[model samples]
Each structure stands twice: as structure tokens, then as C-alpha cells.
Target: MQYKLITIEGNIGAGKTTLAKILSERLHGRLILESFEDNPFLPKFYKEPEKYSFPLELFFMAERFKQLQHSVNGPDLFHDTTISDYVFIKSLLFAKVTLAEDEYKLYKRLFHIINKQLPNPDILIYLHVPIQKLQKNIQTRDRSYEQSIPDEYLQKIQNTYLEYLKQSDQKVLFVEAENADFLTDSKHVDLILDALSKDYSPGKHYLQLS
Candidate 1:
């Protein structure tokens, strides 16, 4: 199948961005990356989650909505190929883990409204990695705001991703990132593109990294 829109989703340090960039270049698709650096509430929420979770989630929800809207309005609409580093649905996964009960309720209401207006991706690539690998990657990347991310938080995010994939009807491609070197391996990149080209059946689609 030829997907006009492709979304890459994963927990922090799962290498979604790297794959998205490579795929976009390989496939000649436009790339839409999540604006994590510009998110003012992210660092604050990471530091004091209880106090800042609601605002942070809301901000992300709004931004993601706008980004999707822009994607729909762009020339990519006619180009037949686009890749994004973050999927809009992943917003709720983070919210579920980060927000308090009341905050989550409110976030859900807003999320439904925003989600109803956004365009769904023709294909979603979910990257999975072990908590230890995620921790190691985060440390190596040295993103200051991410330095304090707890193992439990990464675990929750990973679990939430799996649950979301199980319940979702969208065409999904699950990739295990434990040993994939997407940045340097052409064969690995080709394997991913081939997986995306295939039918979206349930279950993991393992691609050997050369």
C-alpha cells in the first residue's frame, strides 16, 4: 500500500525522530517533527509533574492539533508522501501517565474535540525499546530536560504504547529498536520502508538490522 501520511511514535529515546528523518529522505516525503524544544511546559512538568501536568498536556494537545492541520493544508496533501515523528494519539498516552485523575478527565474532553478535527495517518510506525536502553540513550543524548526522567516513567510510556496499539484500528507497524542502527545502516532503512509498504496486519514486524 502507498501511504500518503506516515507517523512514527515511541517513548523518549526510542529513535522515532531518527527513523522519521531517514524515511523522509529515502521516500522523498515531507517530515514533521514534534516541537519538544519549544514546549515551555515540558521541563517544568518533568520537574514537578503534579503541578504542571495539566498545562503541559494541554499545550502539547493544542500544538499537535495545529501541526496536523498545517500538514493537511500543505502541498503534501497532493504529494502522496509525508512522515511525522510524533502521532497525535500519543499525546493521550503521555497524559494518562502524567496527569492526575481530574486533570486527565479535562484533558480527555479537550483531546476528543481536537482529535476529531485532525487527520489520521495512513500508517503508524511504533518503535519499542527496553527501559534500560531508553535510559542509556537519554543519557548519551544529554538532553537536560530529559536527564531526570525516571525508569518508572519510561516503563509506563512503553506499556501505554503497547496498550494503545492493541486497541487501535489504525494500520500499525511495530518495530523493536533494541539493536537497529537506522542512522548508519542502509539495509535497516530498506527493511523499514519495505515493512511500511506491506499490509498492516496485527503483530510485530521484525526487521533485521545489518
Candidate 2:
């Protein structure tokens, strides 16, 4: 409640979108979900990461920047809070795992250029679920492209995300999600809200719902 903008991020199938939507509705905030459904390169990238990583990342970066620019800068007369399922940095994180060294360097430069122009979230909540749970969630979601995603790739992505969070200076609330399923339990959702309702400085914090 203290922050005007919050970002909920996690690995694929970690329930970020669902949590973001719930928060938006509960707080009467505007919700900005990442529009990746239309990305032509996504299915191909999943099928052939090495062949399509560069273009996929590039297209994603452009789209994320465009969406955030409009939504973050747009009017907020009707809402006091803005919540998004992703932060633009996600592009860079995924690129770190998917791109070659040279490609990552080029991508980093582009990321910074566009990133500085966007608003940073006041709080970043990262849901940390085990890879096994994440895999099950992915299958449950049943996106065809994602069906081919191997556990190794998911592990790599999880590592990259955790590494980024470990080094980031932004305010973050890392939630352990092995047992907490926000979609099914009201208590779990309340725990997340409790974390957000309190004050946190510019450092990493922890939340675990029992």
C-alpha cells in the first residue's frame, strides 16, 4: 500500500500473472500483464533456442518497453496503484540464459538504453517455487510451445533469475513458494499482501507462508 507501482516476477509458470491480477483487483489498481501471446518468435524460440534466441529477445525487449512506456506513463486518475506481471529486466535475465556472449553484450546495451527511460517498480516480489512444482504448473497451463521446455532450461532460467536478484540493489521481497499456492488459498494471498503492506528499504527481504 505504500508503493504506487509494484512488480510481481517469477520463472515461467510461477503464478506471477495470477498474483498480479489478484493484487490489482484487491487494491483497485491498474494491471499490466505482459503481452507475449502474439510473439511470433516465442514458439520457435522454445523449439529452437539456439537458432531463434536473438530475434526472440529483441522482439520481446521492444514490446516490453512499448507497453511499460504507455502504461506506466499513462493517466492514473482512476487507480492509486499499478501492478505488472513482469519487469522489463526479465528480458535481460532471459537473454543471459538464452543468448551467446556477444549477443548478450549487445542485448545488455539495448536493455539499458530503453530501461533507464522506464519507471522502476517500488517493490518487486519474486515467487520462488521448486523446479518440480514449476514444471507441473507449466503442464497444467498447457501452452503448446512451453510443453517442449525441458527441466534443464527451467533450472538455468531459475539460476539466472536468482543470481540477478542476489546482486540487484532494488527493493525486493523474495517469497518461498513450495507450499504456498496463491490461487487456491486465501491465507497465502494474505501473506503476500502482508509483505507488501509493510515497509522495506532498498534491499532484499524474505517472505514464507506457513
Candidate 3:
């Protein structure tokens, strides 16, 4: 099937943005990147997760909703393909992991409302890697705000992603980033394209690009 909207999802440092860029270029699709740098609450959340989790999640949720709205109404709406670095649901996953009980309740209520209003992706590609690998990637990238992220927190985020994908109704493509070099490998791109074009069963699946 040809995808009009494709979303790439993963924990921070899992390389969703990189793969989205590559896929957009290769597929000649318009790119919709998450504005992480523009998020004011992000740095504070990293510094004090318990104190700022709700605000950070809320900000991301709102931003993603706006992006989804634009993607559906913008010039790319009629285009055959479009790619986004982050999925809107990923905000809920993060909120579940980081927010306090009361905070999460409020967040969920708001999320449900926002979710009802946003457009859904035609295909969602979820990327997974070990916490150690994620930490290594984070260190290599050297984003100052991300340097304070704990391994335990990263693990929680990754677990939430797995659970969310497992229960999601959307057409999902799960890719293990344990050894995949999406930036350098043409075979990986081919595998993703093949998966997008084919009709496959839901649940967790892997594509070994050879």
C-alpha cells in the first residue's frame, strides 16, 4: 500500500529523526520533524522530571496535535507521501512513564481530547534499541539537556514504547535498532519500503535487511 502519512517513533537517541530524514529524501516525501529544540519545558523536565513532567508532556502533546493538523491540511495533504519524526501517541507513552498519578490523570484527559481531534497516521514505524545503546547515542550526540537523563528513565520510556505499540490499533512496523545503521545502509531503507508496501499482520515483527 502507498502511505500518505508515515510516522517514525522511538525513544530519545533511538534515531527516529535521522531515519525520518533519510526516508523522506529517498521516498521524495515531505518531512515533518518534531520541534524538540523549540520546547521550553523540555530542558526543565530533564533537570527535574517529577516537577515538570506534566508540563513537558502537555507541551509536546499540543505541538504534535498542531503538526498533525497541519500535515492533513497543508499542501502535503494531497501528496502521495509524507514522513514525520515523531508520533502523537508517543507523548502519552512518555507521560505515563514520567508523570505523577494526579498529573497523569489530568494529562490523560487532555490527551484524549487532543487525540480525538488529530489525524491518524497511515503507517507508524517504531524503532527500538537497548537502554545502553540509547545512552551511548545520547552521549555521542552530547545534547546538554539530555546528558542528565538516567538509564532507569530511558528504560522506562523504552518499555512504555513497547507496550504502547503492542496495544496500538494503527498499522505499526517495529524495527530493532540494535545493529541497524539507517543513516548509512541502503538495505535498511529497502526493508522499510518493503514493509510499508506490503500487507502484513499486526504485532511485533522485525525486518533484517540483507
Candidate with maximal lDDT: 2
The 10 consecutive residues of candidate 2 with the worst lDDT sum are: 177-186
Compared with the true structure, what per-residue lDDT tens digits does model 2 show for residues 80-184?
Answer: 999999999999999999999999999999899889999899999999998999999999999988887889998999999999999999999999987877777
* Cα displacement (Å) at residue 165, model 2: 1.0
Candidate 3 C-alpha lDDT tens digits along 1-210: 477888888888989898999988878888899887888998888788778888788888888888778775577544468899987778888888988888889998988987887778887888888888889899999999999788899988888888777687777888877777877787887888878887766555666544
Q: Lowest summed lDDT over 10 consecutive residues: which window, candidate 3?
A: 201-210
**For model 1, where is the 10-residue window of minimal lDDT?**
201-210
Q: Judged by lDDT against the true structure, how good is candidate 2?
A: 0.92
Q: Would you estimate the TM-scores of all the predictions?
A: 0.93, 0.97, 0.92
lDDT over C-alpha atoms for residue 128 of model 1 = 79
Runs with alpha carbons beyond 4 Å of true place in candidate 3? 75-78
lDDT of each prediction vs. the true structure? 0.83, 0.92, 0.82
Give lDDT for model 3.
0.82
The C-alpha local distance difference test score for the whole of candidate 1 amounts to 0.83
